[model samples]
Target: MTALKRRGTFAYFLVLVTMLLVWPMGVILMWAYTPWSKSVKVAITICLTILTVLTVHSVCYFRIMPS
Candidate 1:
């Protein structure tokens, strides 16, 4: 494959990895939130939200970036 194709492929893989990795963390955060301190739960929720946003952004960025 050409370098551009390789870069695109790598970008896709990174997005996949980010999604896979964040999903479990998000699940765990959801599970851990119940009965916990509001502050802690809110923090985890915020972190999970940010990860989800980043995952989506990376996927879109990879798809549109010249490669």
Candidate 2:
């Protein structure tokens, strides 16, 4: 196969891996926060946001990287 095709395949795999992570991460974030702990909620929110951004960025990065 061509280099571009290989990169595209890698990108697809990355996307799938990220998608698989989203649900468990989300659940963990939810469980980490409760009504009593506003601090934990805010921290979890920030972490989840960063995680999402990084996942998107990584997928795009791999797609553009030379293969």
Which of the numbered candidates is closest to the native, going by highest lDDT? 1
Give the TM-score comparing model 1 with the true structure, all chains together.
0.51
Which segments of model 1 are wrong by more than 4 Å? 1-33
Q: Please write out the lDDT profile of model 1 over residues 1-67, one tens digit for every residue.
A: 8998887677656544543676664445445433457786677567777977998999999999998
lDDT of 2 by residue, 1-67 (tens): 9998887677655544543577455445344432337776567567767887898999999999999
TM-score against native, each model: 0.51, 0.48
Clashing pairs in 1: none
Which candidate achieves the best TM-score against the true structure?
A: 1
Off by over 4 Å in 2: 1-33
